[model samples]
Target chain A: MYQELLTGLLNGDIRSLARCISLVENEAAGYESILEQLPGNNHTKVVGVTGPPGAGKSTLVNALITSLLEADKSVAIIAVDPSSPFNFGALLGDRIRMGQHFNHPKVFIRSMASRGALGGLSPKIIEVSDLVKAAGFDYLFIETVGVGQSEVEVAGVADTTVVVVVPEAGDEIQTMKAGLMEIADIFVVNKADREQADIFAKNLRLLAHTKHQPGGWEIPVIKSVAIQNTGITDIIHAVDAHHKAVTGQHQRQLILLADRAYQLIQHKRMKDINKQLLMSEIQQLLEQNSFNLYRYINESSCFTQRGKEGKEA
Target chain B: MYQELLTGLLNGDIRSLARCISLVENEAAGYESILEQLPGNNHTKVVGVTGPPGAGKSTLVNALITSLLEADKSVAIIAVDPSSPFNFGALLGDRIRMGQHFNHPKVFIRSMASRGALGGLSPKIIEVSDLVKAAGFDYLFIETVGVGQSEVEVAGVADTTVVVVVPEAGDEIQTMKAGLMEIADIFVVNKADREQADIFAKNLRLLAHTKHQPGGWEIPVIKSVAIQNTGITDIIHAVDAHHKAVTGQHQRQLILLADRAYQLIQHKRMKDINKQLLMSEIQQLLEQNSFNLYRYINESSCFTQRGKEGKEA
Candidate 1:
C-alpha cells in the first residue's frame, strides 16, 4: 500500500500525494520509509509568505499565486496555521481566502496545524514540501502565520521569505522587527489602501534599507493592496531578483541546509520516545521526594548510554 | 560566591537575591549550584499574567500588585518578554510600566528577555521564580507576552494563571481561545471602559465557563479597566479563590511539576553543545551530498552512546 502511494505521488497523482501527505502529517506507520525514498534537490523555489494574523496573508498568497500562474509556473502552496488541535476551522478560513484558484490545474493548496510540539513544525513542513516538490512544481509557496518563532522556522525551508504587514500594524511592527529583520528577504506593506499606508510603507522601507544584509542584496519593502491585486507583480519581481542574487551564496545555503538537518535529526532522535508515556513515567517519578528531572533523564532510555547501542547498530 | 548568594537568598537579603537571579538568567557558571540550593515548598503563590501585546498586562499587574500590597502581602514580579537580542529595550518598557512600584519597599520587579535558544525560556523562568519563592515573598507574579507558545510555558510555573485581554481583540479572542483556555485560571477583560467591553466580557465568561478544566474550579472572567483601577480587586479575589480551590488537587500539582522537570531536563541535555559548532559540523556533512541529519546527530557527542560515557564519568 505504501509502495503504491509512493508511485502515485511520483506520478503526480493528486490522491496519492494527498494520502502520502496525510500519512506524513499523522506520522503513520511506514512514513519513515516514504521520507527515506523522497527525491531531494528538485530546484523548486520555495517562497515563504509570513506575517501577523489579519495581515491578509491568505489574500496576498492568492494574488501571488495568480501572478505566478500568469508567468506560466506551476505552484504548490502549503498554508500553515500555527493554531493547535489540528482542527478544520483555520483550514476553512484559508480555503475561502484562496478560493479563486480552487479549480486551477497548475495550483495546489494545503493547510496544516502546528500540532503543539516544540521543534516539530519545521521538519513536518519540510517533509510535506518535499513530497510536493517531488511531484514537479516549478514554485512552492509556504504561507505561515507570522507571529513569534514560526517565521524563523519557516525561513529554513524557503529560498525567499516575504514578511507581510498592514498599515494598522504600527505597534506590532516594532515588536516583530527584532526577529523578522534577520529572516525577511522581502517585506510587503499590504493593505496599502488603508490609512497610514504611505507612512507605514515609508517606515518599512527605511527600516529595510538601513539593515545591512549579506550577499549585497538590498531588502526591498513593496507596497501592495493584495485584495485588489495591486503591487503583487513587484513582490514577485523582488522574490525572483533576490533568488538570483542569493543563488551564489554558498555559505547561506550551507546554513539553511544545516538548519534543515538539525530539525530533521532532532525529530528522528525524539521519534521513538512517546511523550505521553514519558509524562506518565515522569509523573510517577515526581511522587518520590527526590525527583529531579535531569537525574531521571540521564537514567531513562531516551538519553541512556547510547554509545554501546549505537556502536552495535 | 555561589554559596554566599545561596545563603543570602535563604535569609531573604535583597542584594544577594538580585545577584543570584542575574546569575541564573545569564546561565553563568555556578548558577546551577544556586538553583540546587533553592528552598522548595514555600507557601508563596505564583500567579502568571499573560496576554497579547497591548492587552494592558503590565498595568493590570501593577494594579494587582497594589492590591496585594494593601492586603499586607509582599510581592515579587518577573516580567518576561519573548523577544531576542536579550537587550535592555523590553526591560526598559516593563520598568516604565511598573515604574510606580520602583521604590516600593515590599515590591520586587525584574524584566527578562527570551534569549533565542529553543526551550530555554521555561527553565530560566522556573529557576528565577524558584529564587523569588525562596526569598519568602507572599506572592510572586510572572507577566509574559501572550502572543504564541510562551504563555502555555509560563503557565507551568504558576499555580493560578490570569490571561488578560482587551475588548478590541475581536478576532484574536477567538484565535487565542484554544491555547489560552487550557492555561487560564482567571480571564481579565481589561479596558472595560471601551466599546463592546460588556459583550466581550460576557463572551469571555461564556467561553471560560464552558471549558472543562481538570480541576472542578470554574474559571472566572473578570471585567477590569486596569488603568482606572476598576475591577482590580475582584481579580485579586478570584485569584485567591482559585488558589484555595486547587490547593488540594494533587494530580494538577503533579502535572505542573512534570512540565517544569521536562523543560529542565531538556535544557540540561542540550546545555553543553554549542549551536554554532553543531551547525558547522552539519555544514561539513551536508557537503558530502549523501549526508543526512539523523546520521550526524547519532554520531555526535550530543546524542552519542551515553552509557559508555556515563560509566566513565
Candidate 2:
C-alpha cells in the first residue's frame, strides 16, 4: 500500500499527493509503512520563508512561485497559519493572497494551521514536505506563522530558510536582534518600494557584516517590491546561488545529514518507549491526581538510572 | 526541605521565595523534595490578566494592585516576558513600569521569563504561585506574555482570568475572537480615556450578552483609565464578586478543583517521564542520523495520538 501510494505520488496525481500528505500530517495508521517505502529522490530544494506579519510573506511567496514556474520548475507551497484555540481549526487565510496561483497546474499550494503547535511549523509539516517532494516537485516552500522564536526552528528544518521583513517593523537592526537574522540564508526586504526600504536594506547589510556566519557564506539582503514583482528575479538568483553554494559545501551538507540522521534515530527509540508509558500515565493522573505514574514508569524502564535512584531514595 | 522552603516563603523572605521558584521553574534536582512537602494552603485568589501587547496590561495591573492594597490586601504578581531565543535571557523590564509598588510592603512583584518554555507559563509557575499563597498573600496575579493564544493557556491555569483590551487594537470584537473572551472571568476595557473606549466596551458587553458563558457568569466589561486609577475599585469589586460566585456555586468549585487536580497530576507525571525520555532521546539523536526524532517523540506520546492518527492514515 505504501509503495503504491509513493508510486501514485511520483506519477503527478494531485489526489494521491494530497492523500499521502493527509496521511503524513495526520500520522494515519499506515504512515510508517508509506514513509518506509518512500523513494529517496531528494531532487526538491526546500525553501522555508518566515517573518513577522504584514511583512508580505505570502506576496513574496507568490512572486517566488511565478519566477520558479517561469523557469519551468514545478513548485509546492505549504503556508502555515496559527490555529484557533477554541476549535483547533486554522484560518489558513495566509494563502488567500496567493489565489492567482490556484489554477496553475505546476503550482500546488497547501495551507496548514499551526494547531497550537508551539514550534512555528506544524508537527507534521516535515512529513508533508517530504510527500510534496515525493510528488515530483522541484521546489517546496514552507512558510511559518509570523511570530515568536519558532521561526528559527522552522528554518533549521528546511534545506534553506528565507527570512522576510518589511521597512517599518521597528528599527531595522532591532529585527536582527530577535533571532531572525541568524536563520536567513537569504534576507528579503519585502515592500521595498516603501519609504526606508533602502535604509532598512543598508542597516541589514551592516548588521550582517558584523556577524560571522557558519560555512563562510555571506547573508545577502535582497530588496523586493513583492506586489509589483520588482527585484524578484534577483531574489530568485540569490536563492539559486545559495542552493548551489550550500549543496557544494561538503562540510555543511555533512553536518545537516548527520543532524537529520541523529534526529531520526532518537525519534524512533523514544517513540517506542513513550507509546507504552504515556497513556497509562495520563490515566493514572486522571484517576489518582498525582504525577507519580512517571516515577512508576521510570522504575519499570530498564534504561533509566532515575528509576534506581527513586527506589533507593 | 519543601516544608522548610514553604516556611521561609511564608515568612516573606525574598531569598527563599526566589529559591523555591527556581526549583519550580527549572524542575531542578530537588523539586520533588520541595513539591512533596508543600501544604494545601491555597488562600490566595489566582487572577490572570492577559491581552495583546500595548493594550495597557501593565498599567492595568498597576491600577489593580493599588486597589487591592487600598483594601489592605497583600498581592503577589508574576509577570511573564518573552525571552531572547539566542541568550535565553529575558529583558525583565515590565516591572519597571510598576515601580511605584516596589516600596510597598504589601505588593510583591516578580518578572518571569518564558525561558523557552512552550507554554506561556513556565513549568514552575504553579509551584511558585503555591509558594506565594503559602506566604499569606490575599491575591496572586499572573500576567502572561501577550501573544494571544498562549495567553489563554496562562489564563486557564488561574482561578479567574481578567482579559484586558484597548479600543484601537483594531476590531475590538475580533480581539475576543482569538479565544480571549471564553477564558475571561471579567473583561477590562482599559485606557477608557481614549476615544473609542466606550464603543469598544459596549460592543464587548453586547458580545458577552450574546454568548453563553460557563458557570452562567456574566463577563462584565469594566472601563478603566489605569493611569488615573479610575474604575479600578469597581474592577477589583467585580473580581471579588467573581470569586464569591464561583466559591458559592458548588458545581463550579468542583469543576475548578478537578481541573487543578488534573493539572497537578499531569505536570508531576509528565515532568518525570519527560526528564527520563528527553535525556535519552537527546543522547540518541546525538548518536544516530536515520530517525525522525520529533515524529518519534510526538507519536510516542498518547496526547498526540489523535493529531498524529489524523495525519498518518
**Number of the predicted model whose TM-score against the real structure is largest:** 1
lDDT per residue as tens, model 2, B184-203? 78888877998877877887
For candidate 2, give the docking quality class from DockQ.
incorrect
Q: What tens digits encode model 2's per-residue C-alpha lDDT throughout A207-272? A: 777666667779898999988998799888887888877875554554454444333432332332
TM value for model 1: 0.81
lDDT of 1 at A261: 61
Model 1 per-residue lDDT tens digits across residues A207-295: 77867877888999899999899999999889889888988587888778766765665455444445676677866775665544434
The C-alpha lDDT values of all candidates are: 0.74, 0.65
lDDT score of residue A116 within candidate 2: 32
